[model samples]
Target: MAGSCAPWVGSAYLFLQSTCKAIALPSLYENSQKKPSVFRALKLALADSTGSVNGVDMLKVHCSHPHLIVQLKFCKQENCRHFLRSYREGALREALQNHLQLSLAITAVPLEMELKAGNEHLDSMLKDEDRCLEYIYREKPDRLRDEEITELEERLKGLMIHQSTSNSIPVNDCTSLDSPSLPCPSQGSSLSPQVTFIFQGQQFANRTLTPDDHQKFAKLVSKKWKQVGRSLQKSCRALRDPVIDSLALEYDREGLYEQAYQLLRKFIESEGTKATIARLVAALEENGLISLAEELLGLHSNEDCS
Candidate 1:
């Protein structure tokens, strides 16, 4: 499950992985002529899995070109459509290497697809590893204003409390970095953690992005930062949109921004301001990074949103 995510199609055998890679047979015919027939069978299998009859019109997959953007066109239904899923070379390799009877791993594109055609980026990546990485690191833009913390004394005075004991509210004990547990409210307790909220009698944490969140996120992305970074750099050039590019993660090292986690954590932290979790989710969506965003939010998008 580490390398896998929800189907590209809301409903299963599909999101990023071409059911073609589920090429259940390890003895897949290397003969070029036979590949098409196999894909047709795969197309049918995918339709069955997704509960659609004749859904996929075309399923093009090549074992050799594992890095070429993965795509499938389903028989259009109401508004059901298909998309180009770009995978990191690593994910594609894993998909190919997988001989699991019923599983395949795939990575999804984390950028706007309409950028200078998929082929262009592929050609650049295929042609020159040294050449493409010469991107000039732009100035990291800062936009959000930091919220000022009000002193407890000021708040106590503002409330006009004349209690003999200190009126200051104790800080929530939930910010413990040592343990990654979310704030859970104790039942029947008079006081709930400051960060806890009750909804329909169920207590949940009003989680915010924190340094610990950054560390956790960094650990998750650290393994494949290069692949993720490469995709980000290429898309940034195409977007030229100042806002997203500014918040985009840096692949190459720059001071504390040396790792993928640092770059991504910096992105989430908003330069130490009161970081809004929505901002990170919005930025990822704008960049067409549905999978990563979903992962952060602890979800698999079941609704098929075009």
Candidate 2:
């Protein structure tokens, strides 16, 4: 009779357990549906209009969530980090494509704490610096401290002169008649005007000519001059009388001695412009500035003395 009562007691216990589960299941499902997963919450916060918090910071705060903490503790997840990385990269790529019309070549998105690749943002920001000047001035005054402001003023002054340096001036090459004291011929050229900044006695212009740039310019000018000379030589039948005289005088001032001599030798045999050429020869003899005089003579026989 006692053994028969044991079955009834066990059935009653099972019925209570089923009843509790039935009561709890709906609330559990509802809560699961209503609450965002840890990853979703992090993404939503990142998409906030303020653009204040980067994704990595959101993840830090999210670790306090019980579900996420439990998952982290138990889940032997090697690939979990990939989820956040891919999401960040996708978002950055989308922004670049839709807004910037740029395609970054980034395979793995770096953490927010890490430095950016290529410093790509710097170029973008500099392009917009003028448009965003007021914002920067008001919000980021540290960018223009008193010392910085003074430096900017000095740069403006340098730009006003259309500043050229000894390196950039091309010695006596007269292709461009610009000097440190004088304004350049192309005043409105996009590259001519520059603002320089001084830091620790070092100077940097907005667009100073480097050694490579000078070398390239010199090569180009020399090539063009040679081509013109060759064409003139080929049609020597027409290069006589008034044409040759006019050419001689024009280049005598411009300082192309070899060119002038080549042309004058055809007609005069003795170039009456000996005085002009003599000055260049004397300057060259000094050797202190042989290249300068040579370049000057190439433009104007008397340019070295001038």
Candidate 3:
């Protein structure tokens, strides 16, 4: 209180009293020595994490676009807008954007009220992402075809990129492993040592994907790696014991996507370096996945072409 502004301190004290009372956490109030320091900490947290003493509609968005409503239990975004490092779960954010075609937000939380709220609402949150992927893979009556969604998503993405700041590459934004991925037909990524595919009539044709595309491609493979590994095994076994196999590409998968996404992300770093669209296609063909091969190529182009 010696160096702090008196009026601001008094206001913060009252805010904390109300918030602490609402939270109903005995330890928070009982710790008398820490009350001032805790008040200061909450003040900083309110600034950084968007917690307001006065009830602000922190989760309401000022939008009328076609959408669904979602109420998040953990309202971590700055007043629940853009993602914050405090949560460090941007992958979930990207997954909703990429897979579910859903925009995620904080959902009308007043922030402090949820500090020690009941666990009932916590169950509503998306904890296990893998459990819900059946919606994508498994059939549904009203579900639109992947091709239609892909094309529509592409158009929307083009519009979004056009409206975005030129200072940053949209591709440099969060990459979703849950996002569909993999190759184009005819031309190859062979023009550059690091590239594995190319689009002849697209904006990114001249750009080099190299190391960036490598990681993305590898993660795509590893995402459905059980399937990829099985297909590779089939292709390898088709030759009645080939000289090399996906087993040859065996890796630790302990970094990058592996660390960021804590799924069964097993891969070797060199797999991306060694991979080619042609080689993957050949393997798929050997395993009699010609249609799947086409889909992979198609999705891959959709990724980098626009």
Give the candidate number with the greatest TM-score. 1
Per-model TM-score versus the true fold: 0.29, 0.14, 0.25
- lDDT of model 2, residue 305: 10
Clashes of each: 3, 7, 6
The digit string of per-residue lDDT tens for model 3 on 1-306 reads 113332111000011111322332233323444222222222222222222322111221111112112112222222322112222343222222222110111121122221111222221242433222222112112322235234443454453354322222223222333322222222453332332222211112112224443444443322233344445444233322231233233334453344222211222232343344444544444433332333233321222221
Task: For candidate 3, list the clashing residue pairs, or say none.
Answer: 59-108, 182-300, 183-297, 183-300, 189-197, 253-267
Q: How many clashes does the backbone of model 2 have?
A: 7
lDDT value, residue 31 of candidate 1: 39
lDDT of 1 by residue, 227-272 (tens): 4434443323322334333434444435222465655554443423
Off by over 4 Å in 3: 1-154, 157-212, 219-223, 237-275, 278-306
Which structure among the candidates has the greatest lDDT? 1
Candidate 2 residue spans exceeding 4 A from truth: 1-130, 143-306
Ranking by lDDT: 1, 3, 2
Per TM-score, what order, best first?
1, 3, 2
